[model samples]
Target: MRSITRFITTSDIVRIALGWSAFGALLLATPLLSPPVPAPLLITALVSIVAVILVCAFGVVRQAEALARRLGDPYGSLVLTLSIVLIEVVLISAVMLGPGEHATIARDSVMAVSMIILNLVIGLALLLGGIRHRGLAHNRTGTSAYLAMLVVLIALAFGLPALIGQDGAYTTAQAIPVVIVTLALYGFFLFRQMGAQADDFTEIDERLTLRAITSTEPDAAAPGIRDVLREHRTEILTRLGLLVVTVIPIVLLSHDMAALLDDGLARLGAPTALAGVLIAAIVFLPESITAIRAALGGEVQRVINLCHGALVSTVGLTIPAVLIIGMPTGQAVILAETLPDLMLLTVTLLLSISTFAAKRVTAMHGAVHLALFAIYTIVLFS
Candidate 1:
């Protein structure tokens, strides 16, 4: 009874109430946002609402991470990835249907996420991890495989569309075949990840090579099996409940947030691409934190899986979703890339090949990636 009581605190109830209150605010404000509220007040209101939504998003990430810890690898990362992707899809769909009818939101946002994860986040992770530990090792086969798939998908989804399609934007007919092939490939990758090659994503520990390492020391105190099970069961249930509760408000509030975001970005005279980049940053925040911690903790393989897996999932799942919705509705799905952006992407992929070419990650490799990331950032803002 005491433990159960501890799980449901007054503070928790108050937070849930506040979340619902925010939802109510969304209902009242979104419909009336037209004619552009006075710039000052509009910006203020938009910033405040975004702040609240980000707080809610952070809560969801915390709970999701807790659930991940309880569940362990592959399943853990899978949960986090799916949750974020759902939010991304919701935001994109809402924006597409908005007054602006954002045709390029999906493409720009997915590209932004891929760049942030592949360059900014991964580069920082490896740079810091390398500086701290000199170098870290991960399963090369898994890392290389992830890089290979990433290159292929990026080319087929982003590159080929520009080369063969109408001004780089795929017509409905062009999109259909691309969607089918991408989905099929993703399905195959998922099976391999969860089944036959599951171990590939983990670190290869040399300690397991010796018989002495497998032998338990007599002086070591062993934990009780039942206690471990009970703890895990309790944690899983509690965190799962929190995850459900937190994610509900995110989905409920995201539509209004998307509407306001478009209004705000346009009002500020921001670049069109900036809108997608900002949205991608908000969505990727949780995973970015997780990847950083993993790298710092010397868990290079987990970092690879999280960063690389996110890019794969973002493209694999997101492009397909966009095409599926856009094609049927006669909505224009713009995926054309500027020549400079395409060049940046090409160089980034090449760096990835070099980074994962070996069994270990080094500071030099990290430095090179970070240099490319710096160039990408400069190009983005300049």
Candidate 2:
């Protein structure tokens, strides 16, 4: 009785209550969400869905980090980024297919993610980490490798379309080649990332080891070897189960969220781009939290890995997939950004190139990136 009571605190109960209530709301409200019922009700439902998504996503991030802790190094960062990117892809796909005028949603979401990671996540990570540690060091080769690939992929997937395509749009035939190129880039990177160049993604951080041990333990006292094994096995299984359980609702609720978002944004006369920003923000919440925590804990390289790796996956994998889907369905995949957005992207890439040029990062670098992010936010809403 003491153990059970100790395990279930007020915080745990609140989380459970909120999760279940959100699940119930989603199931009950999904039927009426289509065609978008009255505005007031729709707003309420939208708020509920978004709120639930944030909660569920938070749960997924916590579990994913638990899994990452056990896995270690490149694989740890890889798992976290892949999990978050999967959610991003699923959410964007749902929005694309749902009822509403969201033709450019995929493009907007992808671009939003790129900017958010490069500017917002990286900015905060570097700033806070530098402030805490004075400066942070990472594998320069690894950081450079990620940045090089990102520049190329971002250029091909986003910049090229604006420069050569018709009115910043890629036709089916044009898109086919771009899609192939992007996928090939991703495959090559994946091959090298997992094998020959794996070291490039790893960092020498003692903190990660300590963090993993603490997070994996279910109780305070140490156990016998056999008990330890059993506990480790139980922890892995529990995390895996929770990961799937939480992720499913996130995906399922996403469709409903997308519907509500599309209708609500249009009615409020919000910018179409704002829909993408909001969706990207939601999708990024988990990853942002994980990265920030890593930075604060002196695991700066992991922050770079998660933020940069996510950008690569977004452009390399998500963009290609979205384009492939759009080509067959005659949906126009808008890959180009407006002048201001493009300028921000260019500045971000340049700053990143300069920031990671060395193995060390300072507060000044972070401050510069944060300033760019500030400009980005102002322009986005203004």
Candidate 3:
């Protein structure tokens, strides 16, 4: 037992490596294996896709926990955002390139993304955080700013596309310009986020000091920049390495998962919109677990930052990437015309109202969110 615990085994690394390797193989095989299978057989494909996502989710959570321990919240936020965007990009790209089954596929996808983040991600995070901390306190300024940015970005990337589709003026030529400008704007935002301008937009939670799980003490009067860099060099490298290792497998698994989802959805007659929702779930699973942990540990600020920050990142970064990529391909991803967007809009507004009204969440709130999630599922199938 002692030997097993203390020594590193080649078999363990092999197992980890094989899991990812198999995923890569599957991704490569999927396009080649375009044999028209029966709808019932697609069930197996769906299960396999879900399994890949589960493995991806588990790996992400473990790596994110390690990152959170070392780099504090800002860097951790970057990790979460990158993972979600990568998955979204992969899934969207695959669906757009695949059979042109759903005309409003992109619209459904964007709506599904919004619903999953607001109704499921934010809802569950707040609920779990509330239950853990009783009455949690987060940075109101950060939350409000994030919400405003999310609304604007979503309106631009998703809402405008839907409206354009309705006007029947969303030509491939027009789409090319839209995508170019959108990508440029996203690039600018990303640069600002990682540059000196970050300080102007970002606000550190006061409550972060109150719940210092593994963060270093804020040295307002302490060392020089050189001293700080030298002291944390090893830690920074380790965190970066962890993130890189985690992201490689995540990308591989996501690629395979995308192919499997296409096969499964085609086989099962499932709505393609559900694809975005599934991708959102997989991407958010790790962050959701972290949010629950922070809430339980009385780190409400962390929960809020994670939940809202991820939502904003998904909208701002991922949607733009999809639009930019899909526009050139002649894939006009639009919202579903079957149901009023008003219903989804109302749910999101209700969730925001509930979250802000009390500034806390509880098990009851979780139940409510779960109920809404159930309603969403029902609507999808119906």
Candidate 4:
């Protein structure tokens, strides 16, 4: 029994691999099975949600030690950004293709995107990071700059569409130009992140090391990247395999998940805004769990980077991808006036105020954010 207990080690990597395999199997088999609508849909949604969670867990564990080794501040941020936004894009695309007669699908999508980034992503990150680190000190200048750009982008991309209306004089020709320009601006931001400008925003110190947060043995020998990669070659390859396997399942499961959500919302007399919120939640689930864990473990830097990075990537990458795809298809992907949009905006404003008001986040703050999340859930269910 003791030996068996010892053998039952719960490694994050192992769990993630199993999850990816399960999701891949489900994705490949679901369509072939063609299960009934509501049941299949619910199952698909659950599977997708689980798959995302597993993928995130895999990313966190695989990257955690490595992130601590090199590029300390900015490491987890990229992983979070890439993973969350990719999930968001997949879910959004699936939903848009589903049979939802709502003409303002694009608007709701944007609103959902905004709320998830601000409230779920940022709020939870701050809450958890604050709780773990007595006070997580972020670069105020970077935070301010990000907030400013975010506000402007939201105003231009999300807020303006509601006022403009779907049938407004701005035809496809006019909209196409705006999207192209937005894409170009995003390109510039991407360039800056990968270039010298990033140096201005990111700072690193030995004090910011993971060793400072978690009670782990510090590696005395600092190995080179090549050596490290060689040592972990199998792990890295496993992660890559896991990522591909997991993503396919998410896409497949999302098809029915979208339909069931729409049906469930309709049957329950829920608001259209609920759809957007659901999409955001599904996509952000994995990242959210990672952030929470890091926060509890007192890794504030990872929390901040992951949360803020995800917010930026969602808007910068996922939103543009949707627009680009929508344009060629002649789909009106502009933000339109909707209750969900207002709710999303309100959540964002509230998050900005809460996070900025006190540079230090505590358990109490986490409770408040969680309370807000509860309220959101209640509103959706009600």
Candidate 5:
């Protein structure tokens, strides 16, 4: 009884109830969205679906966090990153497979996520964390490894196609090799990240470690990751199970949500790129919060793992999946960015290299990143 009480609290029950209810609502409401509906009904459906997805995403984040904290370091971060990416993949795939010309959704969503995580999320993390704790320290080795992979992957996934005049898509001859290479490179990174070079992703600066150790008093409200591990000591499998249940509804519900989003946006005459931004925001909303919290807690390395690691997976994995899906569906998967956006991405990547080149980051770094994000927003709207 005590174990049950500890594992499933009142809040858990409430979230679970809402998640399942949302699942049912999606089934019933999806049909209504197939054809034109009254504005009130459309708004109601959109609002409800958005709410359900958000609620369940938070629940999923909670479970994933428990799992991540319990496992520790790279493993824990890996779990959370992979779980979020899975949800992203499902939502993007759902949107792609839906009606209308969504060929570029995969590309746009990936681009939006890269900007949001790299600039917006990481920028805020550094700024807020720096204010509270002077400079945000992280493992430069791991960060460099992640950036190197990203530069190469981004060039291959987004740039090469454009350069070769494929216009964001590769011919069958080109795609086969690209997919195989992307997957293999990602597999290599994973092997190193989880195996031989795992420490690169989780290493803490020696001075920071000593400071944490010598500190006599710790904040009670801001419990460290260790506290979470002890609390969820025996709930690994249980939490993992809960994670799946929560993620499933979001995945299924996304199909309907994507449909409504497309129809609504068309009616409103909003820019189509906004759909990608919205999807990216929705996909990573909870996870971004989790990263920021980690940042504020002075877990800069963990924040890196979550934010940088996520974009790595986002590009490494998403591109291949999009390519594969495009191959079969005969849909033109436009992965190329416009020249201006490409320039922005290149600057962001270069800036990222400098941001983490030093062992510690200051508030200024964060501001620069956020500035870049602002520029991205302007470019997006323009």
Candidate 6:
């Protein structure tokens, strides 16, 4: 009872209450949305739903962070990345399944998420950390592991399909092997991350920063991952339960938001891909704040995990889920990016590798990433 009381706070109740209220309100409004509606009314409803979804998402991340604090690196960061990606997957699925045809929804969301997290969030993190501490240090071994997996996954998901297919989509036969391979690889990566390679994902102290970054090998000490389940079983269970409860309304409301987004964008004659950007933004905004905060505190490794780790999961998990969904529903999901977008992604990946290769990253690296993001934005809007 005492633990329960400490766990439940006023803000917690309010966030959940607002989530369910929006869910109920919009559930009733779903029918009206099917018909032609006033533009003002349509925009208002969407704004309301987007706002509430973000609130609940913050609550979800809040609980996940609480769990992360107890669990520590690797597992803690894994928990956070998975939670955000789950939101991304759910929103993409909702939009795909909801209203109009959105063949490129999956591709666009993955690309938008990659560009935004990799460039925008990361750029800001590096800039701030650089200014505050002259530069910030990150665990390069773990970052390299993440980037290697990411490079292959991104190439597989975005590049290969465009080269091989007619409309940047796979033949059913090709998709099967791709999905199988992608998940199999991700599963193996997770296995390594959780076991012997856990220390690779953690921060390096100033005294040990050089060896930690340049060793190109795991530490001989082999600091194994903490068995948090054994150590903090009760608190972990409590947070997991709260996380689920907070996530439910966001999941439910995503359908309503999807419908509104499709309708709103169609009305505005907005780019179809803009819906994907918005979905990525909605899911990522809160977590981006956390990443910057970590950067401010000189936790560059955490920022890498949040930003780099997110794109890895975004490509690793989202592509497979999109394929799985597309096959069954006959949605004909498009996984290939356009040539221009492809170029930007390639540059972004290579730049990230250079930025984190050194003992520390400074504003110079961040500025370049931000400039790239600006170019991506111009292409997106123009």
Steric overlap count per candidate: 0, 0, 4, 0, 0, 0
RMSD of each: 4.3, 6.6, 5.8, 6.9, 4.8, 3.7
* Selected candidate, larger lDDT, 4 vs 5: 5
Candidate 5 Cα outliers beyond 4 Å, as residue runs: 1-6, 34-37, 94-101, 203-205, 208-234, 251-255, 263-269
User: Worst ten-residue run, lDDT, model 6?
Assistant: 219-228
Greater-TM-score candidate between 2 and 4: 2
What TM-score, to 2 decimals, does candidate 1 have? 0.82
Say which prediction, candidate 3 or candidate 6, comes out ahead on TM-score.
Answer: 6
User: How does each model score on TM-score?
Assistant: 0.82, 0.80, 0.73, 0.71, 0.86, 0.88
lDDT of 3 by residue, 49-133 (tens): 4565566556556656665555555455666667666666666666667776545555555566567766776666666666665
What residue pairs clash in candidate 5, if any at all? none
**Model 6 per-residue lDDT tens digits across residues 91-150:** 777667777898887777788888889899999988988888888878889999988998
* Candidate 1 positional error at 182, Å: 0.8
Question: By TM-score, highest first, what's the ranking?
Answer: 6, 5, 1, 2, 3, 4
Candidate 1 colliding pairs: none
- lDDT at 260, model 2: 74
Instruction: Write candidate 5's Cα lDDT for 1-382 as tens digits.
Output: 5764577666666777887888786677656768577788888987887888888878877887777666777878787788778767866776677788877777777889999999999999999988988987688888999999999999987898887736667887888898999999999999998778877887486775788799988835644445666776568656776777676666566655666777788898876677767767776776787888888888889888888899999898888887888888988888878899899999999999999998789889999999999998888777
- How many residue-pair clashes does candidate 5 contain? 0
Q: Write one digit per residue (lDDT tens) for candidate 2, span 139-161.
A: 78888888888888888777888
- Which candidate leads the pack in TM-score? 6
In the predicted model 6, the residue pairs found to clash are: none
Estimate every model's Cα lDDT from 0 to 1.
0.74, 0.75, 0.59, 0.57, 0.81, 0.81
lDDT of 4 by residue, 112-161 (tens): 65656556665676666665565655555556656665665666566666
lDDT of 2: 0.75
Better of 3 and 5 by TM-score: 5
Q: What is the lDDT of residue 106 in candidate 1?
A: 73
